[model samples]
Target: MSHADLLPADVPVQLIDPDGRVTASADALPSPEALLRAHEALVIGRRINDQAYALVRQGRLAVYPSSHGQEACEVAATLVLEQQDWLFPTYRDTVSIVSRGVDPVEVLVLLKGDWHSGYDPVATKVAPQATPLATQLLHAVGVAHAATLRGEDTVVMAMCGDGATSEGDFHEALNFAAVFKAPVVFFVQNNEFAISVPLARQSVAPSLAHKGVGYGVRGQRVDGNDVAALLSVLGAAVEAARSGEGPQLVEAHTYRMQAHTNADDATRYRTDDDVEAWRSRDPLLRSAAYLTAQGLLTDDRVAEMDEKAEQVAAAMRAGLMADVQPDPQELFQHVYAEPTPQLREQAAFLAEELSREDAV
Candidate 1:
């Protein structure tokens, strides 16, 4: 299909409006049941995000990034992937991984500072979260390239933030994917900031989707808060990549509804008004509105979803806290597959210090 064939020339690739109205492609996407499920997943995602923040406040976790307003971006995007596909997600994609079948408890293990929590890629086809921004794009390209070489049907979905579009790794990954015709989708969730830096300061380009033009790859921007729109666009992109059409770049336009991380002070750089404005366009609310409009949701159903999410979140939080009372010996366990001489010496030193304190 030509560039003009896939999306309307003027609608900016939207399938759902902020007020829960549907467009042409929206009906072609998920079923009402699926949409309701996505809504429930967003509730779960938000609860997980909220719980992590609470844990951070209680000193149970080192840091937590909020994906509060980007639930549609995460769930709908992951919905397009096949079981054989691979995913490379950044720290903000907890919902994506969860929606793609990764256990939430295993995900928490990583956030709670446990090495054993890092996912086995062979089991999950999802990489451990990349904290350094945009580096995972290169890994995604490499994985896709390998799949092509081995005549495998596997594709890759690499998730990043809008800020990541400015990274050198982003540029390199795009170039490599385009030149090699790698089966990859570079999904960018433009939540309006790189930590505290606003979108304008991060890039001169009016839209991140335009970045793909420089690499000769297909690109488009979608309303990230619209679950139907995200699912539609991602489905097209995933199909294109799997069919050997090379890479596609999807820039999901959304906003963050909370601080960048627990350690961040968003109030210092952005106003409460700014957050509230985006909260009005929140993915969870939009999905709930859509479901209610379709008669798939009721107040009772919403309450049930909220209660279940809360219960699961509470259990995860309890488990996380139970593990947070650090085992001093654990410091020696995973420094290396086997400890190095220097690490072994440091572990011994720490052990001796603890022993002395115990004796006293």
Candidate 2:
């Protein structure tokens, strides 16, 4: 049977509504304590994203894809994974990777104009941020399939936006996973707009979640802003895939409150009113309200949480400000197992330039 055979069509399955009420059965609900933890993570991720955005404007970072409005999905996805699991993230998913306990400064190295990845992929189990759309999906499938063949239990979560769903690599990765029963979860953060093009202009599919059906994988839809529902669904999906249920696809219905990045102006394609409508449903706001109602977060506690967020922001700023001189020869580091003649010549030229500058 298809993994998504039991899911209803047209209706996106959402456990927590905008008001934070359980729309689905209470059985699937995360514990109250879990909700509070998720809320804290989302808040921290948002603060860090905002700090990165400000630095980009101040010229510290070349550019940063803000995760301001998508923190719920980002945090929940990372928290649901096991230590041995892998995460393949896009350029915009730095928040998710950081939540995996990566060094904040190293995670932003590429955005800081460094050419290679900051962290060791094997050690961290997180592939570097893929700027090319949907390419990471291909890498994710390869790793997941290898795990299956080796009889090791590893679930890989590959994250992308709705626009990346149209790429050929996206289709091939899902198809391969379905055929091989690869333990991979494809999380599509449908943030309403991909750059300037809205979802309406991307694909006319009834929903991006349904993309998995064609490849014989399970598919789900959830309110990306609802931390409770995201954790619940993603947690379940991760376990299911690990148990040989094949790949799964989850389309998170969300909105990007900020521009595509520090460089793009969202106002040109979308109206302010459109963004304002989503503010009422902001993930942190709804989650905090729910926690307060449950007596988990008093006003004093809220203040403490805000302080914690600020501290994280302050640390991220300090880390980014600290500069490390990159190795000049590192440019030829990963291009090939052994540098080709032409590449060696280029490396030699760069080496000479650096050597001359050092003497002065």
Best by TM-score: 2
Each candidate structure's TM-score, on Cα atoms with residue i matched to residue i, is: 0.89, 0.94
Ten residues in a row with the worst lDDT in model 1?
Answer: 3-12
lDDT of each: 0.84, 0.88
**How much is 303 displaced in model 1, in angstroms?**
3.8
- CA deviation > 4 Å runs, candidate 2: 2-8, 338-360
- The deviation in Å at residue 244 for candidate 2 is 0.8
Tell me the lDDT of candidate 2.
0.88
Q: How accurate is candidate 1 locally (lDDT)?
A: 0.84
Deviation from native of the Cα of residue 33 in model 2, angstroms: 2.3
Write model 2 residue lDDT over 1-360, tens digit each, in one string. 845492425766677777866677888888978887888788788888889988887778999998888999999999999999999999999889888988778898789988878898999999999999999999999999999888887999999999899899999999999998899999999998879988899898789987787778888888889988889889989999998888888988888889998889888999989999999889998898778767888888777778988988888789888877777687787889988999999999998998999899
lDDT by residue (tens digit), candidate 1, 1-360: 464432323345766667777766545767777777778888988888888788888877777787988888888877788999998999988888888888777786777777675568779999888889899999999999999999999989999998888899999999999999999999999989999899999888757887887778888888889888787788889999998899998888899888888778889999988887776788787777778888889989999999979987887677777844567888678567978999889889999999999999
Q: Give the TM-score of candidate 2.
A: 0.94
